[model samples]
Target: MTLTKPQDLSTEAIATLIGKNARVYTTGDMLTQDFVPNRVNIELSDTREIVRVWLG
Candidate 1:
């Protein structure tokens, strides 16, 4: 799915847009030890704003 640039989307919006099971990473949060490298990393800003969307 293609996301619009500079859109102020919330985590929920991003989750819904991508998928409920998609991996979400907020700023300062530690990466999961068992995290698998794939298309499921969604980075969010400090205010819970979507900053980046990952796809594999």
Candidate 2:
């Protein structure tokens, strides 16, 4: 649940570390089908945020 920890670097592992209460966002390239996440925003006492943009 604590994000400031060094061991919590991997964003994908957040689901297991915090359980279903956490929020996860995933995106992919339209042509390549390659998944990528650009930025992550976290609100106070709220779940995490993931912002993905396709640079076409």
Best by lDDT: 1
* Residue range 1-56, candidate 2, lDDT tens digits: 75553333244565456443333333332233433353332222122233432221
Among all windows of 10 consecutive residues in model 2, the one with the lowest summed lDDT is 39-48
Q: Look at candidate 2 and tell me the lDDT of residue 14.
A: 56
User: Mind giving the per-residue lDDT tens digits that candidate 1 earns over 1-56?
Assistant: 66555566555765688665466777778876664555467888876667777653
Runs in model 2 lying further than 4 Å from the true structure:
1-5, 21-56
How high is the lDDT of residue 53 in model 2? 21
TM-score of 2: 0.22
Candidate 1: residue 37 Cα off by (Å): 4.9
In the order shown, what is each candidate's alpha-carbon RMSD? 5.3, 10.4
